[model samples]
Target: MFDDRASVATAAGMRLAQAGVRWDVVKVRRFLGLQAIEHIEQPGAVAVDPHSPEPMLYFFVPAGTLADWDVPDTRALNSTECTTHVVLPPGHREAPPGPYWLLPPSCGLTPTDTLHRALERALHRPDPHPHFRIDTAAMRADAAQLIGDAAELPESTVLPQLVQRLRGHLMVLVPHVEDRMRAFARTAETRLVAQVTVGEAQRRLNSVPGLTFISEIKHAQTLARSVEALCRHAEVPTHTVAKAPAPTVGVVQQ
Candidate 1:
């Protein structure tokens, strides 16, 4: 955007800037329809987008230096015919240098690192909800009977479908969990009536069967995170720092 037209000097200046490794932005030119700078000389570095058909130009300058780039074509662009959109992506200035090496010792753990550790630990931890053990073969056979074609599908394809079916059945399954909990309470009450120890009742209550597996819980949470991250990555204009998805469940982590 040096205040000069495209010529040997302009090209040389661009080359010099590229070689110098300094940076700025993305410029968009809204012409008859939609057009963007699809590719550029530098891979992830600066780029320029200009309308080939029209007198207008679109440039990918480092975020802050839009004013500088538009200088040459300012008069022409500020006229009635031309329109330029200088889209500044999420701005980022390099962090000021500090004793970063000393961080590992001094900064105990960043919030993100701490969260990751907790989620990882939860994921690895024994499934707190482990209770019923399904007969895999029987379950597969039942599934195969219900969906004739799907049953013929390989395990890789079928297992996920089965799991999805099970998840869909959670509303049905939750009632069973509730019934079991009620039964446990009744038994505990009866035992307590018969003068059993409080510690014994507590142990029995804690031993109640869990509704699902630990691995499943952790995996669901992981999957949720991945989906959220994918959405964020897609939603955000640029790939700069975007907020992370909060942990929601377990295997996905329980």
Candidate 2:
């Protein structure tokens, strides 16, 4: 059966204990101040603070058997306040392994590299599912394309419509990209610790499922070229200014 909130919290506490990381209710209070993080109950899914507005973090515990629960892309939490996700590996008989913490941009790790490391450690799986990785790359490429398209749109009646379309595309793609990037960074870190070549590690990433989007590769190259052109334009000085010399400190003779 899927783990409940109390069960997940207990497991999370246990993991933290094993890692020698202390948890204090006081710390939660200190970080959140007077703002109350509300909890809501969702059937077949565990959710905490579901009702709160933007900048609110929600935690979910999967319902039904842990194996049956569809593991969501951990990257989705990157934009949310924070989301605690739990996933079970194959053949597990007991509760799913984690109440892994997911913090948003407001948390310490805002950059892609840092967030990726944290997720890898949290998931702790030897092999990430292939679909997850491929989808992630596709998402990144799609997001980049949408961003480019949005940039190219002329300020006109159709511009708002184009911008909205890009936003919708990003809403779907950004999370997957973030999640897979995290997993990749973590796995790469492990390989690094074992003194493996970075190239080999990347090769392993290439092996992951759904990575067959050759078009995305071409798109990324095009994007890079466009960025280079933009940079060159930016580098070209627009205007020249006259220089002024500093005044001497010594008194001038009359």
Candidate 3:
């Protein structure tokens, strides 16, 4: 019988510990795992396999616990079903190209209640599309940065390049958002249907870096056409401000 401190040494300079003998593991995706880490104060022995096809984090919990986990995108690994071995680092430090510790083992394991609540919040309390991993917060930050850049510098200086960068990021986001809106339109009320189309156009236009386009551009239709063209050719070569026309406003200047 293995004691709490006992571990079977392997030839690969790693150790294998039998699950349910000492502790159970809560396996989760890296994103959700990060979320869980954010929710908890001090987590225990969180191991991450960054090289895996889908990187996973393993959270050590009390043995014979959380086997029938109800949390989404998480798996509770215990020895209830079968014998399991947990690959542990040889020492108290991280080794790359293999499992490394995000949070090394402490005197305690992660509380299941805290972990479950964290996963629940991470799942339901974020943006509208909870299922999709659209980092809208990062996108909004980029948009804000673009606004600041446009305000600080002349349009001819470096504003064009800033706009292009923001535009590329927005292009990647637009299609995913459009598809979600369309799906909503089909099931939503008739009055809501037109709102989707209008909102879609407005959002695309509004996402065009500075607020000047919405305020000063007289030829809205032409600008809309340009934005649409960019959306359609998102995968193709990127068009500079000189090539992309900004109607009635010399924002591009070229």
Candidate 4:
């Protein structure tokens, strides 16, 4: 399983072999980081799994040869990913089109890489799935606010009582949330250990049933009601009834 760092290259290679492809791309920093380097040299040799994947920027240093491939970049990445690199594999002949770059531009050189060209295209790129475009960031923000409020319950409230109140309100929403989740589990007709971008995950998830915006909004509203009910449990306030309207003169006509 490529889930293990050590297995990623071999797993990637096997996947490529299955497809009869000889090359796959790698990110430069990652290629170097995996080598356990405390810091990367300006030009250093990097071992690459050519069988990686297209749309991947294969990174290799120009200063080194295959002989320098004594180490693998094993460092993990997070905040550093976007800042580090995107490069070309050493000794690789048929590099991808103009948008593709053997060397990522440094300093003030005019942008000639595929990434730059692709971003230029993106400005004009047509919407592939217009209807499914969603604001997941906003959705996540709302969820964070809900949980943040929930975490503020008074210490005096017993956990059991909290659970009892929340349960009835939870029943208001459909607990057997439908086909959207099922797709994630069953979409394995052909599987490979590969990197998938969040955009791709959303694109696939959008295809599932009960995943439309209106459906999501309804679900969110139901969840909000349940959470509000839990919060109200802490105060146990009484609901004041509005007085009935006085009978009007029309009663005489009746």
Query: What are the models' TM-scores?
Result: 0.16, 0.21, 0.49, 0.18
For candidate 2, write residues 1-254 as lDDT tens digits: 22222322233243111100111011111112111111111111111221224222222221111222222343232212332333312211111122212221112212223323433443443332224221233334433543555534243454333322222222222232333333332334332232222232223222222233444343333333333322222222222322223334662321
Residue-wise C-alpha lDDT for candidate 1, range 1-254, written one tens digit per residue: 22211112222122122211122322222221011111111122222222235323223222233332322112212212233323211112111121011011111212222222333333343421234322333323433433435534334444333443332222122222333332232334332232222233223212322245544333333332322222222222222333334544541311
Q: Clashes per prediction? A: 29, 5, 0, 13
Instruction: Predict model 4's lDDT versus the native.
Output: 0.26
Q: What C-alpha lDDT do the candidate models reach, one value each? A: 0.27, 0.27, 0.55, 0.26
Pairs of residues at least 3 apart in sequence or in different chains that clash in candidate 2: 2-64, 38-49, 39-49, 116-182, 130-209
> Measured by TM-score, how close is model 1 to the native structure?
0.16
Give per-residue CA lDDT, model 3, range 188-236, as digits (tens). 3421433444456446544323346544222233233434433333222
Candidate 4 runs further than 4 Å off: 1-55, 72-103, 107-254
Best by TM-score: 3
Which has the higher TM-score value, candidate number 2 or candidate number 4? 2
